[model samples]
Target: MIDIDATLVNVHSEKEGAAPTFKRGYGFHPLTAWIDHGRAGGGQCAAIMLRAGNAGANTAADHQQIIGQALDQVGLGAPRPRSGP
Candidate 1:
């Protein structure tokens, strides 16, 4: 599991006739992913439930790759503390 800071990106609104918002409602998306032996695999999956019409901002393939790269850069590729003390 990787915790993301939702405020860092732009998201759309799902409600009709409503303006797009940011960092409101649920502020996180849980990705149950694993980078194993130089490969990525996992059965758990989910997405951040935005207001409406927000699906295009981050799709499955793009998001997975983004998160995977971030994890690699932050030393998450190896075993370590997942959270702060």
Candidate 2:
């Protein structure tokens, strides 16, 4: 399964996409997707997209785009890692 999440990153200086965050800090917000491997704890990052700190958290378009990017990154068109030793 794929789990998507967003995180706040603090920036010390001005950055191209950095902006004031709700936490009253300046930085970027990045959305990321991870492939879950259950008890194996072998999850891997599927994709990541960066947005300005002020970007809305519940934006549908952002969610959809991130999911699509994650799918494309790990889709059948891409080779999967070897499953066995």
Candidate 3:
């Protein structure tokens, strides 16, 4: 399974790619994708997209791209369909 998440970072000073967030705070909004290992153990990170502070939180395109990145990390190609339920 793939887990996607985003968090707002508070920028303290001048920095590249930094901007004013929706909360009126200055920082960045980074979108990340992770592989879920569930009960097996700790998972791995698949991708990270560093977006500006004012970036859209629920953008469909961003989510789609991130999902594709995670799929690429699989390296085994697309999983085959289950033969039976």
Top-scoring candidate (TM-score): 2
The local distance difference test score of model 1 is 0.41
Better of 1 and 3 by lDDT: 3
In model 2, what lDDT does residue 53 have? 98
lDDT of 3 by residue, 1-85 (tens): 8888999998899989999999999999999988985887678989998999999999888987788778878874475443324
lDDT of each: 0.41, 0.83, 0.86
Off by over 4 Å in 1: 1-55, 78-85
Ranking by lDDT: 3, 2, 1
lDDT by residue (tens digit), candidate 1, 1-85: 5543233233353434334334444222332333332324332222343223223345555465556655665566564343323
Using all chains and alpha carbons, the TM-scores for the candidates as numbered come to: 0.27, 0.81, 0.80
| CA displacement after TM-score superposition, residue 36 of candidate 1 (Å) | 24
Model 2 C-alpha lDDT versus the unseen true structure: 0.83
Q: Per-residue lDDT for 67 in model 3?
A: 81
